[model samples]
Target: MSLHADALTTLRDWEAPDDEQEALRRRYLTHLERHPDGMLRAGRPDHVTASTLVLDAAGTSVLLTLHAKSGRWFQVGGHTEPEDATLAGAALREALEETGIARADLALDPVPLLLDAHHVPFCGPGENVHHLDVMFVAHAAASAAPSISEESLDLAWWPVDGLPDAELAPFVARALARRRHAGQAGSASGAAGSSSDGGGSSRAAADQPSR
Candidate 1:
């Protein structure tokens, strides 16, 4: 399926953890319904973007990039590309491209973790643009070392509890919670003779900027 169709299906089937998230989920669905090209950069004013928050294997720290244009610390992500087959794939691609961490060492959770909508003043020619960002989570091997990409001024892994951007605390918390829940669920499923697995921001920098 196309990325747009994949995004629609993903969000439609996603069970939001809270009422606020459910509302945002509906908003994303509505946007897609109104604009067929909503998942692409060409969808003016508003478009869908994908991002991934990278965590250490122990979930102690999160890898962040000091965005070159926004000059703010944020997760690694960006606009969807023609090469991307799905929204989650786009997010994984951004994480890999922006972090310079080997794919072998970075494991992405196919399920999205959060959704954020925010304005970016630098995106449009003269008007601000809103990015409907779908955030995903990933875990990196302890030995994974990230190199800075052109999109970032610097990249580093900061303690999850001591993030440079305080606004990110909530996002990190949610991701960690989901990770733990997945772990528990996996154990439970395995104990039952089987195995099962399942699994935002803005700068006004709330979400990822168009790159």
Candidate 2:
């Protein structure tokens, strides 16, 4: 099946964790239906992108990259490549390439954690592009050191509750809140050993001129 079709299926099968997630999922599916090339970067009108929230082993902190273009800390992700077969695979690939996180060491929950529709600049002259982003959560050792990539100015781990001041995207706050909620619930369910599987911080920066 084509990647676009694959994306449709992925979104179709996923049971949204909340009303907001359900709305985003519906928007993504609608976009896909309207644009057959929606999954490709060259899709013109807009495209589907994948991102991941990299959490530490204890899930207390997250790894973020200071995007060279936006100059703000954002999750590691980018346009989907041809090798990507599924949305989750695309997310993992972007995370691995951008963060230098070993695939073997990262444990990704393939389900969608968050969905965001945001504007991205620099597509072409007088042309606006939007990214329907599918976000995921991955866990790695808290001690794992991320090797900075050319796409980022720096890489750092920020406390879930104590994030530094910067041009953070609005979606970042929402994603963080979901992560914290999941962590609290996970902690409460730890005694039972239940396997709990669990964006937007870059919208305005992507729209505005780089500082």
Best-fitting candidate, scored by lDDT? 1
Off by over 4 Å in 1: 194-211
Candidate 1: clashing pairs of residues: 201-206, 201-207, 202-205, 202-206, 202-207, 203-206
lDDT of 1 by residue, 1-211 (tens): 9888999999998889899999999999999989999998878788999999999988899999999899999999989999999998999999999999999998888788899998877875648678999999988988897999988999998998799998899999998887777666655545554323321111210122111
lDDT, candidate 1, at 188 = 53
**CA lDDT of each candidate?**
0.86, 0.75
Least lDDT summed over 10 consecutive residues: which range in candidate 2?
202-211
Which parts of model 2 have CA positions greater than 4 angstroms off? 165-211
Tens-place lDDT per residue, model 2, 1-211, is 7677878988998887679889989988998999878888888778899998887776567888988987777888989888888888889888988999777777666767778778888655336888888887777766566799998999898887766654344445555565566556555555344444331122211112111
- Tell me the TM-score of model 1: 0.89
The number of clashing residue pairs in each candidate reads 6, 1
| TM, every model | 0.89, 0.77
Strongest candidate by TM-score: 1
